[model samples]
Target chain A: MSDLTLTPNIDGADDYYAELLAMHDGLSREESDALNARLVLVLSNHIGNRTVLSQALAAAALKPIK
Target chain B: MNQIFETPMYAYSRHADQDATTPPRHKVIVVGAGPVGLAAAIDLAQQGIEVVVIDDNDRVSTGSRAICFAKRPLEILDRLGCSAPMIDKGVLWNTGKVFFDKRQVYDFNLQEEGGHAFPAFINLQQYYLEKFLVDRVRELQAEGAPIDIRGRNKVSAVGTHPNHVTIEIDTPEGSYNLEADWLIACDGANSPLRAMLGKDFVGRVFEDNFLIADVVMEADFPSERWFWFDPPFNKGQSALLHKQPDGVWRIDLQLGWDIDKDHEKKPENVIPRLKAMLGDDVEFELEWVSIYTFQCRRMEQFRHNRVIFAGDAAHQVSPFGARGANSGLQDTDNLCWKLKLVINGDAPESLLDSYNTERVWGADENIQNSSRSTDFITPKSGMSRVLRDAVLDLSEKFEFARPLVNSGRLSVPCTYDGSPLNSADALDGPDRSRPGSACPDAPLTEGFLLPKLAGKFTLLTIDADAPDVIEEDGITVTRLALSLKNDPTLALKNRYLGEATSGVYLIRPDQHVAARRPSFDDKLFRAAIRRATGKE
Candidate 1:
């Protein structure tokens, strides 16, 4: 019963995905993981709605039916 | 060698005081003839006060020490009649680019809106700055200004008194003693004057060293500040490149905390680093090489009885933001006007306390900003570095994260908010020119607004009627009226009288807004002048 926009929310989706990968290019394994964690925190702070965040977390954790 | 540093400009010369039977008393004695001390001496002399400047050394600073001069200090220098040569010889630029790991993250333009006289910033060698100031001092002296700069004369001991201060000087002949009604210490961070008085600064010492190399024969680089974070040339560190006058380029490389001081400063060792960064094809000669480790610190109080402290003698900050000499100039600019009023007896001695209050506030602002820039540049902890890198990474693609990059937030004018000198603010105008703020310069029909407000208390009115001059308790306040008809561009209205149809501003001698109102009020303006001069 959550009203969260989950379909095509980002423009230039491929570019953002490529940049997300490029961000960890020269960093070590631990540094890349730290960066990902920090990026998650930064984005979470940007999107401060707890209800939407909770829904996004649930959706990200769910698996596709095989 | 650069002739400015090599040739002694003010060599040791015996003054009449040295040969006198009784030690001659001076109105004001400024210790240290560096840029700050020279500026203090110049300001005090220009105000008809007899001032003497003493220094251990005889020449301007070497190695092109402080290169970046910000707008506010430039404005102050303009008032002192020394900005013409500085602007003529300085490399003016407002654009700065920040690069992260070989790719540019973002670029910024400090594009101050048009109509101001000076640019946002200029890069001129410190030697040139000091030399120009010395030249001005000479010009003032030629015009019979009561100013004397005694070189190779050092102050070894200082005795503070209730009404005056006794200074013991050291020269080749012998030690001599003199007294002064007031003493100003601009003797730099390692101020011997501060030590003689058992005073000290209390702040943080940053654990980082930056290698500065002033190289001649620079390549075709744009006249802009280019800063790099964790570039390949120096992995896990930062670098800065700036264009200076005379085809010289200043390059700073971050060498971590625990490095050999002497070994790293060698030309043989430094050239390798430079070659690595410059790709070995470029031809450049190292004009000067220096390693500097900075601290963000300041004294508990600038005023100590009859002796006062200004510039590095009072406070210091890391060199990241070019705040050292810049803020030192501002310190004198804030102090000299108040000191002049106090010395002239137009205002009470309590007026000098406003100098301590306002400049201490200014020093704290510089220290805080430079400290933050130091932290951002050299992250202490692993998590901090991670967070810094994350911000830089995000800044590459995200416009919102660009503001997070702090490669030295350049120095700006400090607004003395909540100052005791400030009267109530009632003008419905822009906050940038509010009470206790530096007056933002705008173009007048003739020349500029700042030149008109030079070295006096002014009542500025825009479309508002006010008297030509007002005298309150022996202090004089003159009027500078401007109308909307003359301001065709509306720069004045936009900067000072925003939204309001008319405005009146009471400006301090140091070009700071003392108070503002919607329209002219006789009693209010008179009372504000009294308060500004510390009569209240």
Candidate 2:
């Protein structure tokens, strides 16, 4: 049952990761990698995106990427 | 006693202070009756002035704690007429959705880019908005109006002299001394008279703690706004429910920074993590449970000598983006029309130092946009939680990553830019720049909007034969004819008026446009009403 139809074009970062899997009915990949590094700096400071936020900060390797 | 001072505005100011031994002076007092000091004592007793107020609490604070009001604080509670009975006992909400984990990313409707007249939020229950503002300051003290409220009086001291502001009080008939001619302080956020004026509140504190509860539910859950990212029973928690008006529900969780704040008042460690994230035949009961702990602070000054400070005693944020009591009721609707134009000398006292430099630059930009929405919903490491879960897993297959997975940039509105009541047409062009922001609510007819020309001091022409520019010191225009099928973003009427010159605008009695001539020149509409009532 996942064609993802909570609809209304869900995108505030996938409706906050489907409201964090309906408030954690499931999640554990170390709590979805600690809420995806705070949702890639909160959706890269809100939608300025920076190339999928530098590929999610080089797949979460995170450093001073000046 | 004696029917509570037999109302005729406190029995004609206590029979015009029969042989006064003190207790009469008040061109403004107002300490804290809440709802931004009873909306600055009902907009300075509906502009006739006087106003007293006080309160150290004898009533009104059942703690529902600001239950969302917005639509610009219901057009500043429809200019003190009490927003149609707090919008007929509140609960409007125009869609908000956002859940990433259970998959459903963004949904904001707010009646999609529409006009405005109240609908874009309204929950009502900050103790019934302070009992509908203490029943409109007891119907302006039974329609006589000098306004005085007392309530177990408290202010235990506050000197400031230069032409009045003595204060002292302690009541239960034991101590007293009150003089006024100015003193505001909507005493909150521990503002004991802004700590008896040694001011300097500065910022940032967050280590995150949240918890809140307020339940009742028999779950069918539909009133939108749920939010739960990564909530496996408190593994780095984050949950939020909402919907409240009777069958109640206001949840919120977040807990991080390693628990133990009195083991979060165990109800068996919070009812099995709210019955494991609300399921298992959802029942519900909790009704009230708190824990909160945020601090984004502000007050470097919201006026000092003569006293003034509104809401959370001038700034404190981190309810994420509820923008702390709607920016403390827009700092009591921008310091009640600049303290009713400097106690009615119609401006000067340096327009009350531009209400502490535009509400301390709107409380340091709403505490840095609610601390960048609490660091994008709690990301304190683990590579910022794997870059916030790879942007919620590439916002589930991008569309230019859906407005960065729907953040709407901490709901816009924060613009003052070096204030001193900003001018050069509120700092030059782009159709009257955003001098201390808030205005933007367009779309006119068809179920009337354009902020129902919000509470007064409006102009907004858009050429319905634009002429009558008023302001010989009465400033309350409302024209609004606007066309092009009411507004297609009109991109600010085609970049500051030229799609055949129309929109005049102006606004500000805290509805905020404060200059947008584009065309209808009458010395740029009386210099945008003397630079929005600070009489340039």
Candidate 3:
């Protein structure tokens, strides 16, 4: 349980990725940025455990910016 | 041995012997006599502009359609001078409950801003709304308002010129032509004018279908909205139950796509489903039923030279939120004042562009919210369904997940946050009275703030010494003072001033805050009014 649970939890990951891309189809850069911000907040609220979220954030930051 | 609630017939005797050769001209001709068209006509006539309204139908809507009237429309109608009778006839409701299967999940009060003049939502038949508006129009006509509402007059052809539109109308007697300097189309989703112009309403059409049933039943159900997701009786579908005046209950059952609409509409099929939801012991007579598939769409542009679109002609959304008619009323509210200003030469023609800008923004907001609600209610994919079910399940346990449960987002008036007409609030006032928002109505000593601020630009000086009412050609300045601390629970003061001691608010004819200052300044106040009206 302590291990970072990051291995493809969402079923049909490719379809979800396509859906995510389609959601940003018509939005401007600023609107897309705002959407990302809102998504972060909403998902953060869903994952209510603060330590788990902190661990996820740290794990995410470990990856270098492309 | 049966009695029917027949709509009183309206006599349309005025007929011009003109065809395309000798068309009678008017300042503005509004098509469709639904709530939106009548409201637009009444608002325009009140603004001292003559209008001619034409409708294909001769009576009020046959069924109880568009039953949910939001507070924003109630306030607009109040300004138009016919909200009293509507409020009396409408069933006032503010609370709603959400259920998952057999368990009650959450409830909402819509605890609207305290001291606001109207409740959040009122359930009234569309027919009663039309009847009251027509009566008001007749009374105004008798008192020398140049507004003519011709029933059974349908527009068969529409042609737009640079300065005017010539429409061919087919009447019961015969068809004739009329010209208008401007044409306001309040026609519904299947707008003939839009079709004639070849403009398509652009957006998503969902595959889900819902059967809306109105039944006349005498039951002890509370007058509140109840929504169920996969309720026990309805098996795996969603259902909604709402109360209306005259012992009518509206039940919307989610019937998945590809179902035979005619078969589902049959009493034999409808009664069993309703019986499952509301036990077989309860007797109800079927009144009306319709199958609806949600379509969230809007026109690219609302204005086309001399022709403008309002109501469902301009935009449409899913019925989940009560956004359809409420947003349409706001469309007319935004439009009539601008059209009047342009016609009377108080503002330039370019002022109309702001109406298009603001209402399109409003429509997009409504469509987005409505689409989100529809998506949550009818999850299309397996992943979406799982996530939605998780949210619903978690909503029963966790308080944080309650907001995620999107049963239906109730309609709220959209604020034009970045509108060009909104003057920056220098006083750092409260959000309620901020620029580009409808001024929060509070109980003024005279009456309510909204109605008192109608028909002209108003300068409201609150918590300050009463300044004599300023009389401008198209502006009115009224000053009233109520001690912020001494006022009743400080609701009014909080709505207007927040922590500030005194301020002056400049409001537009539609009751949107144009500008606000900590104290009165003649130069700054007039400048704000000029900018708001595009006189600058």
C-alpha DockQ of every model: 0.06, 0.06, 0.05
Best by lDDT: 1
Q: Model 3: per-residue lDDT, tens digit, B26-116?
A: 9999999988999999999987899999998877777777888988899999999989998998998878888998999878776766687
How many residue pairs collide in each prediction? Answer: 0, 46, 0
When summed lDDT is taken over every stretch of 10 residues in candidate 3 chain B, the lowest stretch is B1-10
Write down the TM-score of every candidate: 0.91, 0.33, 0.87
Task: Give the Å shift of residue B394 in candidate 1.
Answer: 1.0
- Compared with the true structure, what per-residue lDDT tens digits does model 2 show for residues A22-62? 44335666776667568656767975656655654554443
Query: What is the Cα-based TM-score of model 3?
Result: 0.87
The whole-model lDDT of each prediction reads: 0.87, 0.67, 0.82
Instruction: Score candidate 3 by DockQ.
Output: 0.05
List residue ranges in candidate 2 displaced over 4 A.
A1-66, B1-20, B32-168, B171-174, B177-228, B231-261, B265-290, B293-318, B333-335, B345-394, B404-409, B414-471, B474-511, B514-517, B520-536
Q: Which candidate order results from sorting by lDDT in descending order? A: 1, 3, 2
- In candidate 1, position B247 carries an lDDT of 86
Evaluate candidate 2 and give its CAPRI docking class based on DockQ. Answer: incorrect
The residue-by-residue lDDT of candidate 1 on B1-536, one tens digit each, is 45678878888988879888887899999998888999999998999999999999999998888899998999999888899999999998878889889898888787676888988789999999999998999999999999999889989888998999999999988989999999999999999989888987889988889999999865676888899999999998999988999989999999999899899999999999998877788889999999999898999899987889999999999888889999999999999998888888888998888889999999998887787677778886555576678668766655545666678877889999989999989987899999989999888788888999999999999888999999888888899999877786788989998899999999988899999999999998888999999988
